[model samples]
Target: MKHLSILVPDDRSGPNTVACIAGTYHAFTEANKYYGTLGRKPVFKMELVGLSKRSELVNGMLMIQPQASISTIRKTDLIIIPALGGEFLEKNFVDEKVSAWLRGQYKKGAEIACMCTGAYMLAATDLLNGKSCSVHWKSAESFHQLFPEVQLKIEKLITDEEGIYTNGGGYSFLNLLIYLIGKYYDRQTAVYCSKVLQVEIDRQTQSDFAIFSGQKKHGDDMIRKAQEYMEHNYDRKISVDELSKELAFGRRTFDRRFIKATGNTPAEYLQRLKIESAKKALESTPKTVNEIMYEVGYSDAKAFREVFRKITGISPLAYKNKYNREAAELLFMNDAN
Candidate 1:
């Protein structure tokens, strides 16, 4: 049986923290039971490992007592890091013991999986330096600032490279658990777990769910001004030359500053801003695709649809059908009429 060590971080304390830990444990244990029904031995010998025997989180609301301490586990087949709660601050939150333990486990041939902002903890070990990771889109800016070497694939729901795996933000960790079940067990087992847990399997991207809020935390005054201008005037055609001249900056300098601050070029930023606006209109208004396109300053139908697909991984009508509840109801009433 594979020994799975689910690390209960000493510093993490919150409802989210509790959910991930309990949820992961439940999923794996349930998978084991499913295996037993098929006349097979349990696949994983799972245990909660920590720096200490017991730890209280969220102001003592949740107390966790680990089955094994970090020093006690000389070898493990897998390490699962649950999502951390709260803001990922600039303060040094890297636990040396945990980091060392992770590295030792990896060297000892253990695969690592980090759920949501647990990627932050994995990145601290420097194992994810050159690896691609999927984090919550909301934390993308902060994660970029902290771990620039790690390639952040915000649109992806899961990232698996080498022995390290990562999942995107929120309750999407359930998807990762399902994925791991498919990998470690059989596909039939994974499907069974999904149905039992009420989670959809094979969800590959979080793009459609991502809300594009421009990254402006880089502290460049001119770039901030440019971002505000683009956001305020996203409903009209925006020329890069006009922004440059207005800021009295040369084209190259303007581009550099904008990219440095926002992690997107001037054009990409504008496109995202327009798409975000378009998404809002699609969700709330009974607007046609062309109407939303024109409302967001796009005159070309084909160009707008292409860009929408490129950014959001879905077409305009599909997005509306999925999100526009009022429009759907109205259409139903019209059909009745």
Candidate 2:
């Protein structure tokens, strides 16, 4: 049997660790039971792994004793890092012991996986310096600012490369777990777990769920004014060049400062702003697509749809249908009719 080690969180991390560990442990053990029904021996020998044998979870309410310490486990087939809480990325809980041990295990041939914000600890190992990975969209900006070398693919629900795996926010970790189940076992085992786990097996993108509130923390007053202008005047067809001239900065300089401050070009910021507005209208208003498009300064149908899809990874009508309360009632009423 291959050893499956699910690494427990440190004392400084969040309570999210509790649920993440439980979910991961349950899925693998439940898969073993499924295998028993098929007359095959259990393939995974599972353990709750951590730096110490007994690690106290924070907030003084819970405690977890790992079945194996990383020091005791010389080698394992896989390492699972649950979603880390607190300021792991900010270095408040940078465990050099854990990071070094992870690299050592990888060199000895262990596949690694991180669920949601656990990507922080994975990156701490320098394993993801140049690799592509996904995490919850809410943390995308902070992760990018801290680890610019990493290719942050927050739009993706899951990313896999060179035996390392990561997934998007919260319960989406279930999808990552199912993915591993499939890879470790067989297709049937993965499928069986999917049905029992109530997880959709084909969810590919987290983009549709993303809410883009543009980065605005940078203290450049001119750039901030430019952002406010674009936001307040989203209905107007504005130009960065004209705005730059008005703000007494060259267009190129304005673009540079904007990118440095917001991590997006002036054009990208404008597009996101427009799409956000269109998203709100699509979700709440009974307005036509053309009306909303024109309302957001888009006159051409193709251009509007293209920008919408580019920013949101879904077409306008699709977003509306997925989220609109009015659309849901209309569908139900049509069925009744």
Candidate 3:
């Protein structure tokens, strides 16, 4: 079993990206608990280090210090990066010491795992020169514009032969962690972790074709406007006719364009948005499911439950109950394992 050391860049983006790293650590711990019934112990140890705030060591159960000198990090077997921000590429240099140390670690035969825009840090290291990598689609163009030497593949994720692993975005990050856990443990372990986390992940990585569907670029201007409209009107029962008129397109054209851009009908996409909103409400608000259904524009409780189940594979009540049960189970299992 290899011990893993995940390093989170201390810049502005660290807070948002650290969730993925934390999620990975939690998944590993939980997977070991439920699926390690075969008598074999779990095969990994995870350590976290933050590079933001100050040069102080904040000791905790899952958190490590931020003041680690680059030389002191050489003992780590695998170095994982959550995400690096534009500050790494800003006109004025920042974290040069940490950057140089990371380059040294790479040269020392350490495996480097990068999530989302964290690929930018590896690109700066120049070791990714000939290796193919993937970044968030939103940042893909800017990445290429800055570093032309590295080969950028338009996939959900890319794990190269040279031990450099990069993923497209945060969702891709969770997928990659599951992949890693499955590799070290087993499929059952990965599946259990995914179930515990309430994510459906059966793919090894994000496919290139995932970025495009139905012959649409997904970034088309009209499609963006339609999506923006749907987002702003999440609480309203949006009609295709109203959307078409608002976007100044005919009904047929609007439907075709929306489907082409998002690979889903406007109604379907809006429903997904509403369901996602409902999920947030379930997690954060004290409202009943009926209230939430009406708040998210679903007038019928049965229809709302059906849609939520179809999207998330669990009914709303079951989803909430399962979350609480699985979380408690994980805690006990963690102690037992």
Q: Give the Cα lDDT of each candidate.
A: 0.91, 0.86, 0.68
Backbone clash tally for model 3?
A: 2
Query: How well does candidate 1 score on lDDT at residue 60?
Result: 83
Going through the candidates in order, what is the number of backbone clashes in each? 0, 1, 2
lDDT of 1 by residue, 145-222 (tens): 888788888989999999899999889999999999999999999999999999999999999999999897788998
Record all residue pairs in model 1 with backbone atoms less than 3 Å apart, i.e. clashing: none
TM per candidate comes to: 0.94, 0.91, 0.54
Question: How do the residues 1-337 of candidate 2 rate in per-residue lDDT, one tens digit apiece?
Answer: 9999999876655677777898998899889999999999998999988877687775757889998888899989998888877653464356788888999999899999998898888887788889999988888878877776788888899998998999999889999988889889888999999999899996888888888887766678889898888989988989888999999998889899998887789998898888988999999999988999999999999999999988778899888887999887787799899
For model 2, state the Cα shift of residue 308 in Å. Answer: 1.9
The Cα error of candidate 2 at residue 238, in Å, is: 2.0
Best by TM-score: 1
Candidate 3, 97-213: lDDT as tens digits: 767767777787778888888788777778778888888766755666556677776544656558788777756687777766777688888888888887667654443223221
How should the candidates be ordered by TM-score, best one leading? 1, 2, 3
Candidate 2 versus the native: TM-score?
0.91
